[model samples]
Target chain A: MKPQRCVAEGLFEWPSDEPTVSGSRCDSCSFVTFPTQDACPRCGADATTPTQLARTGTLWTWTRQRFQPKNPPYIGTEPANEFQPYGVGFIELPEGRIEARIAGDIDQELRIGMPMELTVVPFATDADGTEVLTYAFRPIEG
Target chain B: MDDVAIIGVGLHPFGRFPGTSAIEMGAKAARLALTDAGITWKDVQFAFAGSYEVDNPDAVVNFLGLTGLPFTDVYNGCATAASALSQAANTIKLGEYDIGMAIGMDKHLPGAFAADPVQYGVPSWYGETGLFLTPKFFAMKIQRYMYDFDITPPTLARVAAKNYRNGARNPNAFRRQELSEEAILQSPMVNDPLTQYMFCSPNEGAAAVVLCRAEIAHQFTAAPIYLKASVVRTRRLGAFEVHSPWVPPERADSPTVDASRAAYEIAGLGPEDVDVVQLQDTDAGAEVIHMAENGFCKDGEQEALLSARGTEIGGSLPINTDGGLISNGEPIGASGLRQIHELVLQLRRAAGDRQVPGTPRVGYSQLYGAPGTAGVAIVST
Candidate 1:
């Protein structure tokens, strides 16, 4: 089974460039939070105008889910037959923090404050094979 | 020492009462407090009520009518009641009022957790995907912490086991069935690394306290406890976007540390002086770190504390003598005040079955909201 889709469905896809992950910039404090907001939680500033996110950022921290998630979360009518553990991490952007799912197994030597780049990958595929894409981070192989 | 006396304390038992509302719970707690104080409702010079959900306007008006008292409402997520405590203390200390009352109450049901969306801007992926639920989000933290600290599943399960064992003896607790560490570990994992038993029960309950001038407390009751220290802090005002490393130096006298320090300074005591404590254990992992952050132990030593049984009723700290949220259940706003209520009982040596040995002189309670919001206080008998 695929992962469960989000309730608030929007046309979210990253454009390849400096601002990789799309998000709104808080006009008041200049703080950036993902999944967009009307006002900046930081300075209580208005973020009416959302700017694209910086694609390239550093990995502040990361963790992986060793098991399946609950309903309204896990994809399909039934649980996945095989659990494929996935890595998730905090990508440090200039505006704020953005967490992304990871693609491909990387070396285990990952450490805090490592440089990373944002990329788009399949978040989950629906029953009809409709692929939903979401942002992901990978080490910027030196 | 300035004698801080609670002339009144009130409570609505922890349980599932679906028909009850947070507003009703708050009012109930306040009404009971008025009676407990042995003073007319009109005697309360100021009032502060703790609530998380803003849906109930009646809660405010009803309490106002019940006592004809003019007061403010405080909301700090799970720390609502504790925040109210600090607010009332500040008001009383300013000589604005001779008597103050604080109440906490919530009526929440079991369901997938969701919070008010980030209305100010586009929500984070967490908000959009609904990954921001407290249990789910904290599960992520627990998973990370386990790996970093090399903590085993049984070690975490021991916390729930200990709380349940004591909770069974408290008539007011939600889940009083004593559970073993194996049972908690075997329960279905809500999120990886966190089991259903490890999560706080969705409960409906209320708790209240009445504060009077320190010097006059003995007149109300021979065993009036004194408030030693109170502190409340919010995430650095404009640091929401700042992550762990980029955050500013915590405010001088920040709410979390500052409140406890003030408590110790005012009481002329330290963490070492505390005989009993009630920590804000909204989540199992939170209890671990909060105990360390609150100076119960050094950072990363909480797992050891659990292993050594140092947090048990007769252990070195005797923290959370009331079974904590994990067993007593969390009614959001009421949780903070409930901790204080627990401390009061322990300090007075009135706790029946789960009482910590000795007449506790100084007791502490610390509550937290999300990552950065926290409140702490120390009380003495």
Candidate 2:
């Protein structure tokens, strides 16, 4: 396998198998937040602890992005001619809802409340030739 | 607390002005406002300038011949002007200053606002993954809203058409041409349900307002619009907004709701008292959602409101009488002040063609923006 690195450190586990997004759960309030929070946003307590978020969830909402985003930060390697529209939305995980780029054929029909599973995807390649990976959600297969 | 009154309002029309620097536009608006209030720049005791693209809105004071007055620069996303206005009003209300000025100006490139995810507490990886879609954020919000409320595409189209029609009557609006509902629907799709014309572009403009304690109002203008309330609030946890990668299942009151509720509480007036209204129409869908958030109507009632022409001028509840950001193009920092300028014009019976009839007594304006910030202002004749 090609050498790969996660887009942002500590956002999600790498290794390309058994992927899980990281989050923070408040011990006092039972509130959860993605990418981890030092302090609970709900109760303002410092009891937030690291937790792996659910890998599957329901599609709460979605929309197709038709325009090419202004890049500097959007380091996707897709050429302008080969660029295709994509879906983006919030997936309602058991821990909490998280926004993600929807992977797979976006032209296919999508509906709210469909089951979705998290998957690691290629974001870009760094100067060191390391594949930068980011997490996305796709409709779970039967 | 002293009652604050807006004695003068001015605008450097909402449109692109390539050669005009933000400072020059801001100075022009300041001069117009000072002239309208029959006061020299020297008489202004305090100033609050709001801007995003403009490096230093306070620098405009040099062009206006500064009188060693206290000037503060503020930036609260798209609610920049509202925050400035709120601060200016509070300065007068607290009896710290008898007369003050609030101005917002910006010169932006033609596109969606260039925002960094890191600036809003999002990880850089969020943007790297191509999840930094502002229009899609709006579309997703309205999509869920539509799913919950059963609102149709035609209703959204009608909202844009109403604003466009109203924009045609306002000489200062950026897009003064009226668009039909059919035309709006047929416009190229931007995000799924939103069309190209349904979203406002980031453009250039400046607006200013001269405010004074109600006791000293007659010294400025014969018609002073009383600032009943001005409030600014940010999103709490679980409130869905632009740039947030995740939201808790439990929803919190949006910033608009929090700000609007506080504004009405302080003003001792409800939505029923508002004769004219201005809402943040960053997109057509935003206007519909905001209508409910601002307490004008309940959720799921937008379709009926749009179909009945209730939000049009001369209707029961005229909204965005000056065409909103949808028609005016959002100049970020100056957008909220532009709404205040319109309300002032309407209250004084100076809004010639786009005037709301029946001696409008009260007006309300709400502006919601990126990274979760909202501002609400209630004014009365």
Candidate 3:
């Protein structure tokens, strides 16, 4: 088995079992942001607190990416020829709505307000044989 | 600020101009506008040029002789033209420059705009994960609107067909062929609710307008159109916008909403006064959403207004009389000016085959850009 790591540092917590994202809460304005910020974007307050985000939430809105995005910016695991459509959505956590890539079948039914849970998945393989991981949301099974 | 008047307008046909460089296109439009205004390039007091890809659109001065004037380059994403025109108008109202020019041009390659997240102050990971694309935001926006407003998929198709119908009549439009609702609906689905046909292509074009103090506009042209308002606004904190990693649950007015509200206030008019309208139809859903955002109708009222053919060229309130971004395609910098061009022609009763029936007294144009910037302009004959 290859060693694994998160795609970006300090984005979320991953035990390879239960994954939860981190966010920043402004002590000045009580504004919250995902992936955690050092300062508040709303009130420009330097005093911020790192808060753990809920792993479960409801779908706010969603769409599919049918075309291959431009390369330099898009470092998706799939090549143009092997590009698979993926679901993109915003999930409504208790604190804030976070934009995220959705995991599972593209053809799967994804309705707004449906239950969803956070998960970590393979993003890309490095030349050093390390597996890069990213966070995603999956529709919780009934 | 005093009211400004558009004395002359010109456009470089929007499409694939293989040999013409963007600077050349911009120069052509500027020269034509100068010719139409009966003024030489030397007569212009100041000029503002808009472009996205072009490093310095102000470089158009090299093509048009260097008169040693204050020329500015503007790049506000899709709302570039609006900023150019607004600055020109404000300059005139300041009593500094009586006559000035606002010109915009861009030659973009085929497909969507490739934007770096860092440029917009968004995280690089947003672009890396492929969620930063503009089309997705439009699709998801209209999709959620459809869900909340009871808009059907066919209604979106109808909006595209209407633009195509208008485009087919306009000789200057890029996609001049009229598509049926069935054809538009059946087109390849790029984003869930928006199909390939529903989205506007990023193409090449140029447009220019010569503006002066409204009091002296009659000296240049017989039918001068008064610029009632020209304004631009950015996103509020709680609004949903492109290139965002997350959004606040609280809803806030979009830039279009803010700009349009300010424009109406400045113009002392409302949607009812607008006889012809040109909106940012980057996609068919955009037109629908803008119909509400610009205060033409309420949020869900489009579901009813569209069904009754209220937005057709001959409808009570004609929209996109010369086709919209859907037909002309989007040349980032030049797009908003194209809307102004259409409004000038319609207000002057000069639009040939696509003219709205009866004399139009007021015309409205709006432009919405990435990272949440919006521009709005109102004109009257």
A57-91 in candidate 1: lDDT tens per residue? 77655655444444443442334676455666666
Error of 3 at B317 (Å): 1.6
Q: What are the fnat scores of the candidates, in the order listed?
A: 0.07, 0.76, 0.64
Single out the weakest 10-residue window by summed lDDT for candidate 1 chain A. Answer: A3-12
DockQ of 3: 0.74
- Stretches of candidate 1 above 4 Å error? A1-19, A22-87, A91-97, A102-117, A122-132, A138-142, B54-67, B120-125, B148-150, B237-267
Q: After superposing candidate 2 on the true structure, give the runs of residues whose Cα lies further than 4 Å from its correct spot.
A: A77-79, A127-130
Q: For each predicted model, how many residue pairs clash, with residues at least 3 apart or on different chains? A: 24, 0, 0
Error of 1 at A78 (Å): 10
lDDT of 2 at B333: 80
lDDT of each: 0.69, 0.90, 0.90
What's the TM for chain B in candidate 2?
A: 0.98
Compose the digit string of candidate 1's lDDT tens values, residues B23-120: 77777777777786787667778788776664442354564475566678777766677788988888888876889888777777565445533432
- Per-residue lDDT of candidate 2, residues B118-206 (tens digit): 87788787787777767888999999999999999999999899999999999899999999889999999989889998999889899
lDDT of 3 by residue, A1-142 (tens): 9998876777888774787898989999988888688888789999899888889999999999999888657776566798888899989998878989899999999899999999987766776888877889999999
User: Interface RMSD values for the candidates, listed in order?
Assistant: 5.6, 1.3, 1.2
C-alpha lDDT (0 to 100) for residue B68 of candidate 2: 88
